[model samples]
Structures are given as C-alpha cells and as structure tokens.
Target: MPEALERTVYVVGPRWHHHAAHADYAVAASLACQLSAQVKKLNSPIEYRWLSRALVRRLLTQSKGEPNYSLGTLLTEIVVARHMWRRGGSLYHLLYGERDRTLARSLPRLFTRPVIATFHSPPARLAHKGIDRRRLRGLEAVLVVAASQRRYFEEQGVTRVFVTMHGVDTQFFHPAPAPAAGPPRCIVVGGHLRDFETLGHTIRLIRERVRGLRTVILGAPTRWQQSLYSAGGGSVEFRYGISDHQLLAAYQASSLALLPYQDATASNALLESMACGLPVVTSDVGGVPEYTGSDGAILCPPRDPEVMAQAAVRVLDDPAYARERRVRGRTRSLQFDFSVAARQLLDVYATVLGDAGMASG
Candidate 1:
C-alpha cells in the first residue's frame, strides 16, 4: 500500500455516547474527538474513522457471553475485515480492543494489513479468564492506558505493547474561583467499578470529623441506589444524565474528589477532577496511581472506609496542603496533553504500517 493511499485509519469501538450511563464510553468519545482534532492541526497524513454501535445490530443471542454485544457489531467487523482484505488499507484499529473469540481471530486473518487494537480493557477477572485471551491472539500492536494492563498483556506473551496515558481537556476542566465560603464539598464521578458502599462509609466518617462537608454523586446511581446512603451525616446530593458543563462545574466547586473503585483499569473522573485542580482520594488499585502520581493525591486501600475518611479529612482540614496537592495535580495533567499523545500515536501508526520511509520521520 502506498503511504499516501494508506492515510486513512479505521477505528472500531462502541459509540462514544452509546451508553449514557457508562463513563468509559464518554472517554472513548472524548479521545476520538480530541485525537482527530490534534491530527488535523498537525496536518498529519492520517485520518480516523470511528465505527461503533452503528456497525452492529442489537442481537439478543449474544446476551450470555456479551450481554451488550449486538448483531450489528458482529456483521460490521466482518464488513470492515472483508473490505480491507479485498481492497487495501494501512491498518485497522480496534478501540475497544476485542469483542469476541471468533471475531478477534477472524478479523486479523481477513485483513492483509496490520491490525492495531487500542482503548481496550476488561475487569481483572475478564482479562484473566481463558475466554478473553482469544481477543489478543492476532494483533500487530496493543495500546493500553494503564501500567497494570500492559504488564498483564505482556505476561500473556503478547509483544509490541504500548502505554498511553489518558488526556485531560485543561481548557474545559481548569480550576475556577472557589465557591462562596461554606462547608467544603466533594464529588464522586463515573459509574464504572465504583464502590458506593465504601463511599457511604467514608462519607459518614468524614462528616464526623469535617464539619459541614457535603458530597455530590454524579453518574451511576438510580433512586434505589441513592437509598443505600441512608446513614449519611453530611449532605449528599445526587445528579444523573447531567451535561459535561454541569459535571465540570461540580469538579471546580469541590474541594476534594472521591473515587473509591472496586476493580481494575483507568478512571476518567480521576483525570478530569485532578485537571480541575481538585484533590483526589481514590482506591490504590490498578492504573489509577499511574495518573495520580506519588504526591499528587491521597491513595487508600479499597473498601477501607476509615483510612479513606482520614485521607479526606487531611486534605480538607489543611488549606495549605490541599492547595499544594491541587497545584501538583494540575502540573502532572499537562504531561498527558492530547497533542503529545497524538504525535506519539501517529508514530505508532506509521510503525505498525511498516512505512519505513515515513516511520523514521
């Protein structure tokens, strides 16, 4: 394939907003939009075409292994694969990694060019299970956002792996003027793997120590889920299906960000909150520490309410210390800027395409 002709890169994944309740889809959407903008501004010889929900039909048969899987998804993969196999392309990028066993193996055989899988992750359980490994079999490269994921994939004998940190939109999530003097407020964002039981416990403990501290839970909790927090001592507010503007506003107004997750991989809320210069108290699990850095935020063991509560109080009680953490966090966020990641990703694209002439550039 000519370098010029192979400039278009096809991306396959769930629609970024396909699931309004899931934060991962939002991250997928943000990445697609940002990466496209960055590549265009650089006048790079590449373009990304995304395919997700529209590609697959919602078939009920896949409910057992893939409850979310659809007939459209399966057909689309074959469609894209057959197209690349018959015609020609530089590479096929699977953003959600792999969908199913048969598709993962067949897609590669159907493509003459390299197949690059990115933006994929499963809970530690799913990835380790014998079934999902089928998805990793035929790929030219795998891009991960978390260190733990990279390690996990490598341990499985997969090579040519890369780690890309999640990027933050500083312009959107930047710090704002502190809210009117009142009780300090904290926020819990994102629905994936969040441990609300731990959150309730931590909030109760925090309210006992910190006077007038309030919390806002955005994303994931239905009215029944909201009822689980009956023991709240501090004020607790819940909001669902809010706009990004409203979410960012919550981040800016809050003094601390709480992300007590039960399981693996990345957290979009962690990056957005830290970018907004809010202190974070998150579970010390998976790739979270990769973003939070050693000193940027407070890390506590998962399901431990007492330790998490103490960490929150420490940040809220010490204004000077909290401010320092905020400053450090914002500085760390800049390193993961989309532009830098875009350039690096372009290099990966060039390398995987075997464009020796352009890869060196």
Candidate 2:
C-alpha cells in the first residue's frame, strides 16, 4: 500500500492520563489501534508510528518551571514530524490535542502529507494570541468532538468538518443489572483535582445542597480533594488511584453522575457516566450540551456553586425524572460506542490515503 510497508500517523498532545488528558489520549490511542486493524484489512504493512512525549523540560526552563504551552506536548509533535521526514512517507495524519492553532497550522506544510486534526477544545490563551485562520484550511478533515464546536471551526474556515463523538470502552463501562435497593446511590467521577481549588469549591457546594449523599471523588488526591473532604462537613469521601474497572463499578452503582468543571468540553467523565446508565449534572460549557443533550443531563452555569448544587438537588428529589434521564443517557452513549466511532475514523483515514495515492499516481 502506498509503496510502503507501514503507514505512519502521529498523535499530538500533553500527558496521556489524569484529568481531562485521559480521554483525549485514550481516543487518540484507540484511533491508532483501530487504524492498525483497518490498514491490515487493506493488507498494508504494520509500519512506523510515534506518540509525542508527556513531559516538557524545555518549557519549564522558559517559564521558570511553568510552561505556558506544554513543552512535552510540543516536543512530541516535533518528534513525530521528524519521524515522518526521516521515513520519507507521503501520507501522515495528525490527531491533535492541548496545543495551539498556529503550531498545528504549520504542521501540514512542514510534513508534506495529508493532515487531519481533531480539535479537543478551543485554543488556550497563549495560542489564541497569533492564531491563524489558515490553519483549518489545509487538513483533510477537522474533527469536532461536539456539534457545538462546529460553528467555531467554520468561522475559522475549516469547511471539511466531521462530528466524531468521544468513545468509551463499552466492556469497561457496560451497565449493571437493576439493583433491588432503596435510595439510588450517586457519585461524581474524574474530578479535576489537579485544578483542585475549583473542584473543591464545587464539591463543597454539592455537599451543602444535597445532604447525606454518598459522593465518591475518584482520581489522585490533591490538597483540594483532602481539604474538600475535611472541610466538607462530613459528607464527601475521597478515594485515590482506583483502577478503571473499579471506577466503572462506581458509575454502575450510582444513580447520577456529576461533572463539575470550571470550563471543559466533551469530558470523558460525562460519557463514561452516561455509558454506565447514570444521568448527569454538568456545567453548560463547551460541547457538553451537545453530548448530554436536553434529555440526558441537568445543565448548570459554570463556576456557580449555588446553581450546580440546585441541579444536583433536582436529580435527588425526582426519581422518575432521574430514571428517564439515565435511560436517555445510556441510549445516547451507544451512539459514541468505540466500534461505531472507530469505523468512522477509519473511513476518514481511508479517504485521506486514497486521495494521497491518486495525487501521487
């Protein structure tokens, strides 16, 4: 295929796990895995592939120990570019996350192959400074995780757009059988404890509004998680470093899932929770509304503790409404089932390669 044994593609991103990073990296890795299978389906060779590093020592030097943009992520992109150039391959696809529009823009011109970028969210403040509208035009396709992001990219002139929803391993997040029980258990998974100040503040509010609620905060503890439990007036419990399956059980056991983010779009926590047949209470930020929809979740304003608290209370008070939302959420999650989304992504890759092959011929 394409006069080469192995076709190469690269993932551009920050660290692969923890907080929001987990979903983006997981999606990219899954895409790569799926692509490997499809390429074999086409009887192509298993060739070179690279993933950018997760740590940046250089950026730390410039910012005096804090990188404005992730140095590890930038280096990773650069490494991938170097690999493509060295391999002399004419086909490359870029799956981007947590970086600048301008930097991503330069990649297609530099790499001499078809580039496709999946926009994880809007550009950060630094990257926003010299953002180039031209960046969106060169890619074979600009993937938006949520329909809500489509307009923003359109404004930037990225017309060849596709809405590929985020995916979760159904095997990992399958719904549990109906429990013969009393008050439905509820929990919030993947709280961004790295940004604990905001996370803790929101949990405190949830504690106030919903009394005697068994809330489990999953992820490594930052000072904020500990402080939230200590100062939370004996309501919320903190559990650190639980395996993914255990996390899934938490979702299966819970009646509702809460995603309290200061600002985020298409969070994995929301999808995983919904996949486990749990309705959600999440902030109305980014592409979240697109995924959660009207039937699946209760939306609240960002960073407003009072509003978030009330949203959680609403779910606790109405069993019928909660059950309806959970049913809808589970149905919605199937639309993003990995098998479905992976095939779509494989189709995109096939399209890009076919076009490249035509131009070369």
Candidate 3:
C-alpha cells in the first residue's frame, strides 16, 4: 500500500443526465474525465427495470417518505452495492448528509475499505425521519461543501470529516468576449418556486420596483410553480425547460441574475451565472456566502420582497459597481473550475487511500 499510486474512486449516485449534455451530468462527466478515474452514473429507470417486481416493491415499501428513494432510488442502491462488491475500490458517494446510509451499508463486509460520504446540503429529511445520530459512524470521512452542512454533520456524530467546497468550470462559463450593454436585463433561474417565495417576490419587484426592465425565468415548471407564476400576475416571460447552453446564454445576455431560493445549499445556477460575467442577487442561504466571497455578489435576507427588489435595482442601476461585481465574481468562479475541482478531489482520494493504506500514485 503506497501513497503515490493512483487508485479508483467511484462516484455512485442516482442517474444524472449521462445521456444528454446537461450541466449536472456534464459536471459529473467532466469531473470523471479530469480525475481520469472510473465513472458510472446509475439512474433508476422508472419505465423499465430488469429487477423482479417483488424485490422492487419490497425496496419501495422500505424507502417510503424518505429522500433519495424512488424506482431510481432503489435501482441506484442495488446497482451501487453490486458494483462495489464485484470490484474493489474506495467508495465515494456525493449526497447530502447521511440521509441514505442504508445504501452505504450495502458495501461488501470483508472489503475493508472506507466510505467517504460527501455532504452536499443540510440533512433536512434525516432530521425529519428521526434517524439516530450514531448511524453516521459508518462513514470514514464526511466531505462537506458548506459550513452549515459541516455543523449538521458534526451534530450527527460523524467526527472524521473535512470541508471541501464545491468548484465550478471557469473555462466553460467564462464571460462572452463582450457583454450586451443596454436597458436593464434580468435573468431568474432554477425550479420549484412555490416552495420558495423568492420567485413571486422577484416578479413583484419587476412589476413595481423596477419598471420597464426585461425579466426572464428559466427551467421547466412544476404544478406548484405554475401557481406561483399566476400569483405574480403573469407578466414576466417564462421560458420553460431550456438547454444548458440557453441558460448560460441568458446569463450572459442579462444585466443581472436572480437566485432567490428559500432554502439553498449550493446553487449550480448561481455559480454558473457568476461565471458568465453577471452579478448575482441571491439570498444569503446555505453555501452562497462561501462562493460569492465579499465583492462579487449582493446578498439579502431571505423572504423579504422589498429588500430583494431594492437590491436588484441597486445592481441594475449602478453601472460601475455592477461591472466591478461581475469581474470579481467571474474571477472567484474560477476556483470551482472542473480542472481545479478534479485535482482537489484527487487529493481527497489520496488522503483516504493513505488512511486506508491503499496504493496511491
């Protein structure tokens, strides 16, 4: 067991957009390419399955009301367990908290390898399920993306943990050679608006606070989201379900971006928006403050429509300040670039391998 030899680190999770060129899937694929490690994205196929009905039903029954458990959820757990047992390597799962430790426990008992659980968000559901704090001991190290999530993991008694913030790909998200300069252009992105009042508030601001400003909302609509849009008086242009390139283009075209989530962990949209040379007006929730640093973006207390509106106008009206923020944000966004992220991830794998006495080069 040497420290210099490279060892396999598998990222097991529910299926991301492996078939399509989506950002989340692209992030996973890009990370794998950068690390030069084995990458298998397992998505639970809802329409078809090779598993027996009895097994599927039993799994569904056991995973009821639990986060990360659907037909896809069941398939992911089973497939990941089989993959780990069939061929040996260090197990690294990218998920929020230990909400689904049952999947982690499925690793082969005699393999004698460590499971590194990367916590992406606060365990909102684990607390709801009343899962005991002691169960997290199954993981060897908890890699956290935010301080808030780190505190939650510490409360869960997962002492062997480290904080490694999420990174973005600057090269892909770089600002266009030139940004459009004209009337105020605002871009609002992400989903599930009803769950978060930010959308309604943002629309209200567009209607009242900043009149004559062009606003565009991106992503497909959920039923609840439609209700939120209706509540906003239906004046804003809503572009439902667009490609990743379209979203990036919208960010580049707009004067400012709005990421007003109710309870955010780390928003991919916000990061991508900043990387595209637009200053983000986001809620000071989850890992946002960590990503924006001090100079790049505007942070407001969540759930306040007036404050959100005022902040949006401030960025849109002040050209000098807005340009400065965009430059600073774009610069900071480089830290999360895939190349940098892959190298840091490899370091984590090396640390885990060294601890486990596996060969690493």
Q: What is the TM-score of each candidate against the true structure?
A: 0.81, 0.72, 0.83
lDDT of each: 0.66, 0.61, 0.64
**Candidate with the greatest lDDT versus the true structure:** 1
What ranking emerges by TM-score with the best candidate at the front?
3, 1, 2
Better of 1 and 3 by lDDT: 1
What is the Cα-based TM-score of model 1? 0.81
Candidate 3 lDDT tens digits, 1-361: 2123366666655424421133342364356544464433433344445778998788799768565556765666666665566766554554533445565544534355567666564557446545446556567677776677766777777776776666665766779777666767777776732224665756666666665677777763654456556645655567875776776677788888877766655567777888888988888766778888776678888777678778788887788888888898898787767665555555666677777776444
- What TM-score would you give candidate 3 relative to the actual structure? 0.83
Compose the digit string of candidate 1's lDDT tens values, residues 1-361.
2122235455555435623232343243345435543222111121123435432233344444653455555556556655576745445666565453444556676564667676446447545444344566777777777777776777766788787665656666778776325678888887767888888888888888888878888875574255435645526777787777777777888889989988756666887777888888899888778877897678899899999999899999999888888888888777665555554565566566654232332
Which residue segments of model 3 deviate by more than 4 Å?
Answer: 1-5, 14-22, 25-33, 37-50, 65-68, 92-100, 108-112, 123-126, 129-135, 192-198, 220-234, 359-361
Which scores higher on lDDT, 1 or 2? 1
lDDT of 2 by residue, 38-87 (tens): 33211122222333232344444453522335544455555665665675
